[model samples]
Target: MNREMLIKLWQAHKNDEWPHVETGQEGPLMTLDTVISGCVVYVLDGEEDLDEQRRAIVSDCLAELDTLEIEINDECRSYFGRLREIGTLLLITT
Candidate 1:
């Protein structure tokens, strides 16, 4: 796992300065939280499905990292976007 980015996010979260945004069930019908978890974690899901609550936390955490200007590579970003798209589809589909 890309511990570097994850560490940055974890640090930002610990410092209470990540994403600088609030996460809740209330907001956009589809939120980052509503989707899957952190991109890295998502990619490394290893066939294990994550609980919604955990996924939400991870999603917002990633968003926080993005806001903090912590760069995630293109591959990860692409995978992230794909995961988001898949989530959006699922939301719309079901």
Candidate 2:
């Protein structure tokens, strides 16, 4: 991610602020819990398989989570781990 994206990501994820939603199934959509996971979802964007560029972006976003220093609860930890698994394939195949 570039500096601008990093800035936006930090802004969105800062203070553990949740996304504002008037109506949605928050219970089932754990991806929205953090900006990084949300970026994973956006990169996937309903794709059935991961492409190289998409994979890198997702991987970078997941790795970027570490620098954020936010507490990862059980739910987000599981979600992020799953995303990492999906992107890790890029390391071998790319």
Candidate of highest lDDT = 2
Error of 2 at 91 (Å): 3.3
Pick out the ten consecutive residues of candidate 1 with the lowest summed lDDT.
17-26
Q: What is candidate 2's TM-score against the reference?
A: 0.35
For model 2, residues 20-80, the per-residue Cα lDDT tens digits are 3324334323442343354435544543344666566656655654533255555455444
lDDT of 1 by residue, 8-92 (tens): 4433333442232224422432345333434334433453344566556555645553553234444345443444444433223
Error of 1 at 16 (Å): 32
Clashes of each: 1, 0
- Stretches of candidate 1 exceeding 4 Å from the true structure: 1-70
Judge candidate 1 at residue 54 and give its lDDT: 54
Error of 2 at 10 (Å): 26
Per-prediction RMSD in angstroms? 11.2, 12.6
Tell me each candidate's TM-score: 0.29, 0.35
- Candidate 2: 10-residue stretch with minimal lDDT: 20-29
